[model samples]
Target: MMSTPVANHEAIEKVRDLIQGIDNAMLTTMTSQGLVSRPMKTQEVEFDGDLWFLTKKDTNKYQEMLKHPAVNVAYVGKSYVSIRGEAELLQDPSKVKEFWNAAYEKLLEVPYDDPSLILIKIKAETAEYWETGNKTKMVKTLFERLTGKESEETDLNKTVDLD
Candidate 1:
């Protein structure tokens, strides 16, 4: 129930650090069938209030984002971060080249100039993160849970407003 709003530069850096360690994230989109989530490789760039991903323009995810721009991206590592954001499909060739690499060429089997290649820019609005402490603290939490005792830890959860 403890949620601190992160607005300072230091706090923002901490959030960015946590996300930098996570290589992949689950992107959830709303469709006629309900909510659909798929694993997507996170772009290796400094987090600056937004996230980016590369996907085919003809994919269902691209269509879904067009219909319902609202999406959620979940990341897990030493900490868990849940970001609620809006996605926009961009065809900026310069941006594509900025994030392009040899790995992308191997995966798509096509050059960066391919027509189907597009970028998904997610502008994060609000994000919540839960960071767990070291092994000793984790063990204590487990012990408290097993004994049916309420643990007293209030500094592990935080929320940031990126807008």
Candidate 2:
């Protein structure tokens, strides 16, 4: 089922916090045959309800996004975040240069100025996240479960609207 959409600032902040660090995210795109997922380097920038990734114009994902813009990006770390959004293929050279670095140069073996290089901007619509809280919260949750009670401490998973 799809999450109820709410443009709450706190939820957006929570999402940004959950995905702050960690480098890569699994970008899943809809193909003509089925769904395909691949690990792409998550750009080291503020989340702000949107996600960005660098790619080549000739990649299959580029074509998939053109045909079907819906996509999911999953981040696994201390917290797990699954973000759903509509993908847009961008051809701004200046923006690409802004996110370029030595690692991308070494990994992609393509210069930032390459004409084929492009940016995939995911305008996130809804996000669901699971966070592993501190020991105190875990203990509280355990106690609540033992006592047959439900509380905020026991609720570690939630769906947040991004758009």
Q: Tell me, by TM-score, which candidate is best.
A: 1
Clashing residue pairs, backbone N/CA/C < 3 A, model 1 = none
List where candidate 1 sits over 4 angstroms from the true fold: 1-11, 135-148
**What is the RMSD of candidate 2?**
4.2
Model 2 weakest 10-residue run by lDDT: 1-10
> Candidates' TM-scores?
0.84, 0.83
Model 1, C-alpha of 26: deviation from truth (Å): 1.2
lDDT of 2: 0.88
TM-score of 2: 0.83
Q: In model 1, where is the ten-residue run with the lowest total lDDT?
A: 1-10
lDDT of 2 by residue, 25-83 (tens): 99999987899999999998898888999999888999999999999999988788999
lDDT per residue for candidate 1 within 4-102, as digits (tens), equals 555545555777988887889999999999999999989988988789999888799999999999999999998888999999999988888888899
True lDDT of residue 50, candidate 2:
83
In terms of TM-score, how similar is model 1 to the real structure? Answer: 0.84
